[model samples]
Target: MPVDIPGPASSVSVQHEPFDVGAEIAAIAAGRPAIGAVASFVGLVRELPGCPGGLSAMTLEHYPGMTDKALEDIVGQARGRWQLQDVRVIHRVGRLAPGDAIVLVVVAAAHRGEAFAACEFIMDYLKTRAPFWKKEETRDGGHWVDARDADDAAAARWDV
Candidate 1:
């Protein structure tokens, strides 16, 4: 499901199509002279280490409305914490092959520090807070992916 946010400064989309990182970053920075820095992260599906036959593919699933709201809230939180100019988050759903892009997050601010910090913070929170389930497929079979302790720890450091 694609959600086009009402404002040009922010948007959250949960889609199956791959996104263009350059275009996304450019769109947010266009005509915005105040934006001095842009930070972005693009997540990709990779082979599972030590898994039999490696990872053939991965599937992501989410509840439409709920997922959008969760992502929007995350973007809002980032905006509240930093003096941001624009933010865009795109998370792909459905089947994805190895090396395929899974998610894209772009943040723009007047300074590099705020842009980088907010970008990292949003990703850390998204890892544990986003209401999405993932299934990894190998030649042997497929299994649901679970939350990781490292991810939780990453988010915890930013806690108030």
Candidate 2:
């Protein structure tokens, strides 16, 4: 299912190859006169202790139907809360190296504040609400990365 706003153009895809942040930002702003500012964020895998040597690779998994719906809901909330021109979110799944890009978020608006706030809001919501799970491969073995309670707290701050 496609997740996009009703009036503005948006693109969301799951890809294995590394995403070009510059290109995606350009695409979001191209030919869009209403968009005066674009905000973006890219998350990368990091090496963390606790599992043998460190994280060598990570795999992301999601429940097919629920994942898309959750992402759409997040985008919808951003639209309702801000005057955004467009939004895009792309998350990668499968084996990824330590430096690989995990997800990308972009928001466009007529002003910088709305674009920035909405972009951060979507990212915070995704960290907690998205149905995706991460499994890290360390020197010892593989284990599912537990979601932190702090992430949930961060998302809750936006709620009225």
Candidate 3:
């Protein structure tokens, strides 16, 4: 059974298709007059170094239930920290080429501070905590990517 999340305050989806940032923003901002600020972050796939033949594509894989729960938990944490009006997270799976959109996080709040902080918080947690495995493809072949020190440091600042 699907869980019932009351109100239009939050949404999280994992799909293979691309999402329209403009449409997503409009949908979340609609009918919400109190929202004075909206902040968003879009992650894109780029060519990584050390690929002998250069990068061609990347594949993302995740377990259905686990991935959803992890994302929801991250969003819940962000909501607890900030007074947000709305939040949306969309993550793409399957094979994606260079320059493809990987993930989108949108946060709305009455103040720019809350919106910006919440947006970054959600992204930081998502990057480290989400259970997604990535394999980068090059002309030579594909290799499973590993977690980076920079990403860990980004998520560590939220520790209290």
- lDDT per residue (tens digit) for residues 1-160 in model 3: 2222334544988888888999999998999999999999999998877666988999998877888889999999998999998899989988999999999999999999999999999998998998888998888788899889998999999992
TM-score of each: 0.94, 0.89, 0.92
TM-score of 1: 0.94
Off by over 4 Å in 3: 1-10
What lDDT score goes with residue 108 in model 1?
95
Q: Count steric clashes of candidate 3.
A: 0
RMSD of each: 1.7, 3.3, 3.1
Give the better candidate number (2 or 3) by TM-score: 3
Tell me the spans in candidate 1 whose CA falls farther than 4 Å from its real position.
1-10
* lDDT against the true structure, each candidate: 0.89, 0.84, 0.88
- Tell me the lDDT of model 2 at 160: 32
lDDT string for model 1 (16-127, tens) is 7789998888888999999999999999998888896899899998887888888989999999999998899999999999999999999999999999999999999999
Ranking by TM-score: 1, 3, 2
> What lDDT, from 0 to 1, does candidate 2 have?
0.84
Worst 10 residues of 2 by lDDT: 1-10
